[model samples]
Target: MDLKPLLNKLEHYRSEKPNKVFTMYLNTDPADPDQQGGKWRLQLKNGLNNFESYLQEDGDSDEKRNYWAVKEKVENFMNENEMNLKKSVIIFATGDDDVWFADILQMPVKTAFFWEEEPVLDQLKEMQETFPKTGIILTQKDQIKYIDADLGTVNETNVYELDLDTEDWRLHQGTHKADSNLGSGGGKTSKKDEFYERFEANRYRWYKSIAPKLDKAAKNHGWERIYLVGESDEVNDLESHMNKTIEDKINKNLLDHEETKVLEEVL
Candidate 1:
């Protein structure tokens, strides 16, 4: 889900013929943390050994040297960043002109090897399709934060913001002057009620302004779920104006928070 950059790198590698390239796979389950030499480490060694043997069988001395060099690089990489057992790993490494490019994917993949230009991306593509994206929308007053999330990996795809106070509502004296005049006439309503009434009206306008844009964005990105966060009353106010399709995707528990704080609490 957060693999956009990785995919772009692979696309650029399609035409590259490096000194050597290897696609390595390991079933990381039953993890070997710190890579303190455990089952995963053993699997890593075996996978590389098998790949080297395959390359050496019909390869020249130069090919053999490139294979070992890449092997050493991969070993060093694993040492630096230990593999997680919960997710499978598929690594792609290629070296040319003393420069190397490696793409590592930690996801569920069938344990196999592919010595090719790019790592096989079929599993990732499938996962993306299976798990439609998620959106987190936080609406309050004149500010709204819209975030796109990739729930499969708990990644934030994109974030956007909208502010609707081009002309400050607080600077408007007419409404307040009207309130003062009403008070002089012995109006029974509390000052709090008048302020709240104005606030609610603004809420309606803000909600109406953002609903169509949010709906279009959700549909365009094929979002399967949405996390609406705000006071329950305001959440209802905004959602009331949203397209029904978007409304249907809301979670049972509409989250509560002001802005980005909900990101920490929800996901």
Candidate 2:
């Protein structure tokens, strides 16, 4: 969901004449829900009382009217909506149906409000969903999936699982020279080197194809960093072939996780 519009609305309020911001703070702790709510209920009542008294004493006409409407709107919201998981901190400006802002939190705050020119986003600090994250790449011989733990989302399909290559990328065993005495060991060594050259080349080709898609996903999918996780050989091989730009963004936090149960563990 987009919050830029609400943020823009907040900026509009900041620019309005006779500027005044109305804040409503609700403190809560999931550890002791009932008692925490009881404490904050009193704080809310007292904060509302302070706002009402401030409105009465205010000398500015435009701010007075706006805050008067804000006081009423805030009271209406409180009466109509219960303070639950998502409605941790709800702020409003006037009689508008939409609230100024709301934050989802599971942490404690000071439990207060300010009728000042500046709008506070202190609640954002306590919300994990608001923080930046790294894009986690889950890959194996068969699949490649991108997910972000901070945002709690996964791609619908694996990119590598799609049609890419039909050639064998795995190294195969080659027979050694029949005699231990030095003559044909060079032949054995040459065959082993050839197998590795082809195997490594194919792996790099696969990584080259997947890297650009990852770069696009990181740019468009909202992650500041990237991580790689899989078997050591695969992860390291992919890393070597990644674009330098993507390599710079990699956090290299190789997660030791099961590919089958990754979503459960990473999230």
Q: Considering every candidate listed, which one attains the maximal TM-score?
A: 1
Among all windows of 10 consecutive residues in model 2, the one with the lowest summed lDDT is 172-181
Q: Tell me the tens digit of each residue's lDDT in model 1 across 13-105.
A: 563343545666555644435334456767677877887787768666766676677788878877776743345565666544233444343
* Candidate 2 pairs with clashing backbones: none
Worst 10 residues of 1 by lDDT: 170-179
Deviation of model 1 at 230, angstroms: 7.5
The runs of at least 3 residues in candidate 1 whose Cα sits more than 4 Å from the true structure, single-residue gaps closed, are 1-20, 25-38, 83-86, 97-107, 131-134, 138-145, 154-203, 210-248, 254-267
TM-score of each: 0.55, 0.53
Report clash pairs, candidate 1. Answer: 28-85
Q: What overall lDDT, based on C-alpha atoms, would model 2 receive against the true structure? A: 0.53
Q: Per-residue lDDT tens digits of candidate 2, residues 1-267?
A: 233455556655553445566766675444555545456566677887876676668666676777677777776666665544432555645433234655444334556687766566555433334433546675554346555434232333233343423542221122111122112555878765665565456666776667667777677766665667666676776677665233222333333343324543443
